[model samples]
Target: MEFTEYGFPPDYLDEISSAVQKNDIRDLIEEGLIKAKPIKGTSRARARKADAQRAKGRRKGQGSRREAPTRGTPRSTAG
Candidate 1:
């Protein structure tokens, strides 16, 4: 995918563009013109959202809103 296809920071885009003759950042990094910046804990925004979701404990897999009647707990199975 082209870097232009997605939103990239202006400075990052500039570094990527000037890093190598290729438009792809991966290729530039491979060529050693641009060094990949290490991600700080999955990034600021993503980390925030991930931490919030983790605090909420929504992915415990206990149950979902679409609970089905397993063993006749008073449910109509005739659809």
Candidate 2:
């Protein structure tokens, strides 16, 4: 069969035998004929930096307070 018919270049099929079997791709991978690319992991550098800033009291401000200091009570100046 022409290599172009299978979307492969002519030179690419030159190294492989024309009598290649129709085995499953996973079988080829298990037999070490083919390999899959490694998966990438998410980076935590930004998160760690933010945590360090918070630990140093960098992000603590009025907006971060859980409640007001007076708790909505009216203070008497004389008392």
Candidate 3:
């Protein structure tokens, strides 16, 4: 049976296989096909750093400049 029969998104099959090969069972559990006991030793810091790097890479590839904040008349500070 295809993975989609088990309620998983079909497009994620390759990613799921790669995660299994890398010993990342947590990802499978998160996908909700089976219950998994929690495992220790995963690097949370490294995950955050990797995510930041990916975001930076995406922004660099897009090559779009961020718009500067607009300037307008200052509003009264009083409520």
lDDT of 1 by residue, 19-39 (tens): 544456677566554554545
Candidates 2 and 3, the one with greater lDDT: 2
Report the C-alpha lDDT of model 3 over 1-79, residue by residue, as the tens digit.
2345445557666766677443476657665643434456767997798779878875443245444333232556323
User: TM-score of each candidate?
Assistant: 0.22, 0.45, 0.27
lDDT to native, each model: 0.56, 0.59, 0.57
Model 2 stretches astray by more than 4 angstroms:
1-22, 63-79
The candidate maximizing TM-score is 2
Which is better, 1 or 3, measured by TM-score? 3
lDDT of 2 by residue, 1-79 (tens): 2335444446544433442566654454455444454566899999999899999988787676688676545686323
Error of 1 at 38 (Å): 14
Kindly report which residue pairs in candidate 2 clash with one another.
none
Off by over 4 Å in 3: 1-3, 21-23, 31-79
Arrange candidates by TM-score, descending: 2, 3, 1
